[model samples]
Structures are given as structure tokens and as C-alpha cells.
Target: MTRIGLSPLAWLDDVEVQRRAAGLRRSLRTRPPVGAELDLASNDYLGLAQHPRVLDGGVAALRTWGAGSTGSRLVTGNTELHEVFEQELAAFVGAASALVFSSGYTANLGAVVALSGPGSLLVSDALTHASLVDACRLSRARVVVTPHADASAVEAALAGRAEERAVVVTDSVFSADGTLAPLRALHDACRRQGALLIVDEAHGLGVRGTGGRGLLHEVGLAGAPDVVMTTTLSKALGSQGGVVLGPTAVRDHLIDAARPFIFDTGLAPAAVGAARAALQVLIDEPWRAQRVLDHAATLAALCDVAEVPASAVVSVILGEPEVALAAAAACAQRGVRVGCFRPPTVPAGTSRLRLTARASLSDEEMALARDVLTDVLAAR
Candidate 1:
């Protein structure tokens, strides 16, 4: 074959250089199956990822269902396990029905696209998750991005829109900043405008509300006719997959109209089993939710973070990508694992150490974390 003089892919090299210059390049590190480092980087808020029951559930499902889902859910992939999960999940969250998906991103995509089309309007929060942003883009609706957590802005968008069908989307708890959206106010606005409210409870389900039923449940909007909620099993549930909980009509419509739910393979048997087990664990140990929030508050205090975080995430802004990376490295060297978020994941000049609180973190681990984080911050 003739040697290509200049590959079209060469532009990637320049992009990589630019990223490095801005300290925005990202790389992954391989982690052992088990480690000695104190884990403040994971989203295992309830510490159920390695729970014996959760593990057993996954193992048993894997043995029974084999390795894969086999086909799309509409085909051979739907199983008794998936059906049971949907029913239990819907009941637990006070929804009339639920639809499971392979991931939270896909769930949001399906919900947004299925609910809104060319004649509809979608009002989204400016600081919602990337998945939601992508969903908004793919929705084929008239999209208006409102100021973060501004219910008035959402109302205005709805009021000004010509479309009769409108959907206002927001995260129950913001992922990066660990702040809560005004769900009750948003619901009032949606009701006033005859619109539907979609709340992403991925960060709220296991960390907010009474007994972790989620923010919507806490606010009495769980079974509201105009409200739809989506959440992930990978975070607080310490498993994998996503679910959309809403009215029975919404679920039926999604089954027939949502492309992601219809075209994608069903969630793996092991994930469904694990999530079901974790949900049961949450039900039995409701106090675990409060423990996670308490741990997060302790972590935030140790870092002098001013914001009272509403969930398990505690962000300590370091103001520069290199600074945040160095801080995370320092924590890791001290046997404390913390997450460093740079540009793209966070705003420029607001790079941060994103610490997650787990209910299973021991007193000894907490003390160690406090000391390590203090030293890291003092060094700055």
C-alpha cells in the first residue's frame, strides 16, 4: 500500500497538544479489584457495590440467565427478572409504572425524544448533566435552556412557547455542584403552564428525601400525573442500568415510541438482579441514606467548602486544572482516593476535587480522610 503523506487523523494530534497545554487532557488509571486506598472517588453512596447480598444476586442471575441479554427487549431479551424489577422499582418510587434501560444516558435520551417532537417545546436547566444536554439536542423540539435552578425562567419559557406540549427538564440534584433543584417550584410552574416536569434523580435517589425515596417522593410529586423521573442504578444502587418512573400512560407510550428502549438490548440479567437486591437493601436500611449525607457534610467541612451539599457529592473547587490534579494526586499518595474534575466536566477555573461519601466509610477512614484533605488544602 502507498504511504499516506498526511493522514486525515493528524488533526487529533493537534487537538491533543491543545488539551495538554490547557491541562485538560484526560487519562484513565487501572484499579485493582480490591485496594487499600480509602475510596472517596466512587459513587457507591450506600456501600452496596460489594455487599454480599448484591454480589449473590448478580452471581445467581448470571448463572441463570447466562452472559448476555441475547436481543433487544422487544425480542428475546425481556425476562421475568426485568419484569419483576420494573414492578418493584415503580412501586418503591410511587410511580404507576417504570421502564428500564441499559444506562441512565439512554433513559434520558428516550424520555426526552419520545415525549417531545417537532411541535413540542423543551425547557432544560443550563447546568444539567451532559446526557440530558445531548438528549435535548436529539429531541427535535424547540429547546430553551434556562438559568440553573430558576423556576421563573422555566415558567417564562413555557409561557412564551407557542407549542401546546412542553416538557421542563432538570436534575433533582446537580451532579457537579451537589446543589438541589427547586422541584416543588418547578412542579408548580409546570402545572400552571400545563406542561410536564421531568426530573433526573440519578444523584438524588439514594441521597435525598426521606429514606431515599428521592427528592420527588419527599416533595409529594412522586406519583404526580405531569411528572416523570429517571434515575441510575450505578450510583447509589451500586449496580448498573437506569429506569424511567412515571404514569402508566407514559410507560406504555415509551414502550411503543421510545427508540432507545425498543432498539437497544435489555439491561443485563445480573444488573437487573443486583439493582433489585440493592433496592431491597435500601428499603431495609433507610438510615443508610442519612449516613451518606452526614459523611458528605463531614467531608465538605474538612475542605472548608461553603455550600451545604444536598447529596453525596462534595466539590472542593481548586480554581485551576493543574492545581486540582495535583491535589487529587496528593490525596491518592496519602492512601485517600479522590476525584479530580477538570475543564469540560466543570467550568474553566473551577476545577475541583469531587468527593463522594459512602455510608460504609468507617470512623477511622473518615479521620484519615480529614487529615489527608486538610494537608492537601493547607499545601495550597
Candidate 2:
């Protein structure tokens, strides 16, 4: 590959410079298997990722199933664990059927595109996850982006749409600020408009509703034929992979038509095992969910926030991305680790420090976090 006057990719340098100037550049930091830092950053809300039972389950599955799933689920990857987990998860969430995917990203991609097509209309929230955004882009449907958490706007779009088939998409617990979608109003709107509702419960599975049955179950819409749900095993479930739960017909359609599900490799056996075990832990120790919420409330109060968030995440907004970065560094220096979100992880001018509340956070860890945040956020 010979270059001409300038390399074809030379614009990347300019892009990097622009990103650095705008404080949009991101770098990865390697974390140890076990760290001493007081962690308020990760999404392990119930701290089940480190639980002995979960680990043992993963180990057992690893030993029994080897490492990889071999191939796509159509060919060889669908194992006994996948079937059992899917059945259990569907039953837990009150869905008729469930289908597993390689990752939450692929799951979202598969669900959105499979459910909505060229002739369909998709009313998506402004602040949905990037996966869903990309899914909409690939869906080929005429997408109408509604204002963030505006059920009225969503209803308006759905009500006035010319397409008979419409799908409304949103996150149950938004990953950015940990705010919740107006699910009841949205569901009502969808029902009124005769549209299907797809709720991403990625952050809600191990944190929200009774025993973490999820927001759908909390609001009595879990088994509704028009309602579909997607979630991740990585976050609260403390594992890996993703799932789509809904009517058995929808599950059958995804199996046959969703590109991600048809082509992508199946979920690993270890993740299936871990998610199953963590889910059981949640069922047995329902207090874990409430503990996470209580921790979130405490974090909000310590940060001097006026109201607590709906999920196990609390957002502390600082102005510029640079300012947020500095604040995060200060907190880390004081032995507290937090999520420093900048564009495009968050919208411009809304760059914030996202804190996670883990059920297993010790009193000492909580004290350390409280003082560190009080001292650090004071400066910003």
C-alpha cells in the first residue's frame, strides 16, 4: 500500500488534535483482578460479580463446556445452560420466551432491526444507549427521535405516524445519569398508538423492582404481548452476554430474521452459568436490591443532590468535560474511583461524574467515598 501526496487516513491526526483540544480524548487504564481502590465506578450494583457462588458457577460451566461456544447457536453453540437460563430468565421477568445473544450490543442491534423495518416507524428516545441508536440507524425505518423522557412527544410522534407498524424504544434505567424513563406514560402512549414497546433493562435487572424482576414487572407490563425487553448480563447480573425477552412469536422471529442472532456466536457457557447463579442470588437475597438503592440515596445525599435517582446510579453533573476530568482525578487521588463521563459518552455541557452504588460496599468504603466526594466536589 503506497501513499500518495498524503496518507488516506491523515485526517485522523486532525481528528485526534480536535478531540484532545475539546477534552474528548479517552484512554484505557488497566485494572487489577482485585484492586484496593474504593470503587464507586463499576456497574456491579449488587456486587454479585465477586460472590463466591457466582464464581463457582462460572468455574463449573467453564470446566464442563470448555472455553468457547464453538460456533453460532444455529450450528453448535446452543448448550444446555443457554436453554435453562433463558427459560429461568423469562420466568423471572414474566416473559413468554427469552433469547440469548453474544453481548448486549448485539442483542440491542438484533432486537431493534428485527422488530422494525423499512415500512415501520420507530420512535426512539433522544438519550437511548449508543447500541440502540446504531440499531435504529441500521433498522432502515423512518426514525423519529423524541425529546429525552418526553412521553407527550413520543405519543405525538406515534399517534401521527403514517406507518401502521411502529416501535417505541427506551432505556429502563438510562446509563448516563441513572434517570428512569417515564415507562407508564410511554407504555400508555404505545398502547394508544398501537405500537410495540421495547425497553432496555440493562441497568434495571439487578437494581430495580421487587427482587430485581425489573421495571417491566414492577409496572405490571411484564407479560404484555406488545411489550418487549432487552437486558445485559454484564452490568448488574455480573456476567456477560445479553437477552431479548418477549412473546414467543417475537423470539421465533428474532431467531429466524435477526442478523446478529443468526450470524453471531452464541453466549459463552460461563456467562450463562454466572448470570444464572447471580440471578438466583438476587432471588434468595432480595435485600441486595434495596441495599443498592439505599446506597444510591446515600451517595446522592452526600453529594448534596436534592432528590435521589430511580436506579442504583447517581449522577453528579459538573460543567465542562475538563472540569469533570479534574474532579474525577481528585476523587481518585483521595482513594475513590468514579465514572468520569465526557462527550460523546454524555451530551456536551452535560459531562458529569457518574457514581455507582454497590450493595457490598463496606461502611469503611462508604465513609472513604463520602469524605472524598465531599472534599473533591467542593472544589469543582
Candidate 3:
């Protein structure tokens, strides 16, 4: 028998084993209950995930179109539901046109790569989502990371390279902190620099703007020639898929050029139907968005009164990774489940218990969540 040169692989496994021993290992949980529990850990900002109409639409689409979209959109999977959702979403968000993809991850990948090329410079916020980072990597563009949410930093970066084609990208709402970006400043800077601005409204839609039109519309940047927006239906819309809304020419270009949209499988019919229904619910219940924001503000106030930093995600900051994990476990033990963000998910020294707010939670439920969370933080 010949011994192979696998020492590097052995060292890698050894590091993983050490990480597990240090109370830093990661694992997945099985399906949680859907009953009468306070949920402050989900992204269903408007509480449409379990809406009756959304559920019914999903069921109807499943039965009518079968389980899956048979092929890629460019193949046999392009269906009427996709077209309808695209049109409705574009009109609702005030975009010139829209193109849907299988997932937000793919949409970001396709759009970022397609729009910016070798000669292009991609200036992105340092705290932008991982999807955008992946897209920049795949684009092979000259990438520059600006300070998070600092439009002045973005302006400085663009000023240094005014001659190169550029695209400015950032999340409308920072997912971790729930901080809103300076969209108007960023848009204005990009426009002046002759660069395109791409805002990922994954957290903003159904939670901001008039009728949840999103942060861009809230900042009066919607329908601008230099702005493009991408969103996920799985978040606020309580469905699964992603869309890029921009000019008609951009959509046409994506139809021919976006590899993820053309080469990947189309979104399931159920998701399309559920998204459409969710949008209708948003149209009918515009106040739901405000209610969610109100709930968030209330929770933030509760945290602040308790002397904790008021997180947009309503997180309880724990200085150490184990302390954060222990705090979350304590909450779960007391009949409340929350998210624990440690290294990799969080920065090196800022592990925390992330609590997402939703409109569905009653006042009593929010109070209980606060009571339980306060106890957990004190114990930590």
C-alpha cells in the first residue's frame, strides 16, 4: 500500500475538531413548531408567511402546475405565473421592468456579474451581504470596499477612479443591524460619477416605503434611470425567488445575458403564486408594514430601557461567543426561540443573540419576549 501526501487535509480536519471542542461548532435544528409561541427570529417581517391567501395560492399552483417548474425559464419552465408576477412586481415597485430568478443568491450573482465587467469597478459597502460579495468575486471586476453605510466613503472611492465604469451596491437595510443605508446620497454620488447604483431591498420590501414599495421608493430613487433594485420573495413576500427590477433594456439584456436566470431552473409555481398573493395582501393592507416597524421600534425601546443596545434586529449583545450561545439556549429553554450569531456570521468580537421582529406578534407576546430576553441577558 502506498501512503498518500494528505498531511494538509489532516491538519484541516484537526482545526475543525478543535473548533468543535471550543464551543464553536455549528449544527442545524429540525423543524420547529408553528403553534402559539413568540417568534422573534424569522424574516417574515409582515407576517404574510402563514397568511391564508398566500397558503391557498401556493396550494393551487402546486396542483395546477405540478410540483416543479419543469425546466429553466429559457427552456420549458417559463410559465404564465412567472410573467404575471414579474409584471406586477415591476409595477408595484415602480421599476421600468423586472426579471425573476430562482433565488436571491442567484439573482445577485447574475446581475452583479452581468452589469459590471472587466473594465468596471464595483464599489460595495463593506457590510454588504455575502451574496453581493460572491457576485463581485464572480464578476472579476476591480472591486473596492467602502466603509459600511458611509456615502462619503463611497464618494471618495468613486472620485479616485472617475474614468472607469463603476457600479455602487449596498443593501437597503443591513440585515444584521437593520440599519437603513443613505440611499439618496449613494444614488446621487453614483449618478454624478456616471455609475449605476444597485440596491438590494431584501429586507426593505414589505417593511418600508409607501405600501412597502421598498427603501429606494422611500428615498425617491425609484424609477431613476441610474438605479437598479433586487429583492427576495422569501423574506417579506413569504415566498421563494428573487427579482431584478430596472430598465426594460436591462431586463432584455438579462433575458439574453444573465446566466443564472437562463441556465438555472425556474422558480417553483407554488412560490410564484404565493408571491403574487402576498403582494396582493400588501396592496390591500398597507398598514401592515407600518405595524411591523412600530413593533420593531417598541422592541428596540424595550431593549434600550433595559440598558441594552437597541438593535434593528433587536439583538442582545454578548461579548463572548459562548455567552451568546448560552443566552439563546436559555431563551429556547423558556419556550422562546431566537437566533445566535457568532464568529463568521458576526464580526470577531461581537457575537450576539439576533431577534427579528414581525407584525404578527401581539403586544402581550412582545412583552413576554422582552421579559424572557431580559432574564436571559441578565443571566449572561
Residue-by-residue lDDT tens digits, candidate 2, 9-43: 99999999999999989999777799779889999
lDDT of 1 by residue, 1-380 (tens): 77669797989999999999999888888788996799999989999999999999998999999779999899999999999999998898899999999999999999989999889999999999998999989989999999999999999999998998999999999988888999999999999999999999999998888889999999899899999999999999999999999999999999999999999998999999999999999999999999999999999998998877789999999999999999999999999999998879888999999999999999999999999999999997
Model 1 TM-score is: 0.98
TM-score of each model, paired residue for residue: 0.98, 0.98, 0.94
* lDDT (Cα atoms) of all candidates against the true structure: 0.93, 0.93, 0.86
lDDT preference between candidates 2 and 3, better one: 2
* Model 1, CA-based lDDT: 0.93
Q: Please give the lDDT score for candidate 3.
A: 0.86
- Sequence-dependent TM-score of model 2: 0.98
Clashes of each: 0, 0, 0
**Which 10 consecutive positions of candidate 2 have the poorest summed lDDT?**
1-10
RMSD of each: 1.7, 1.5, 2.3
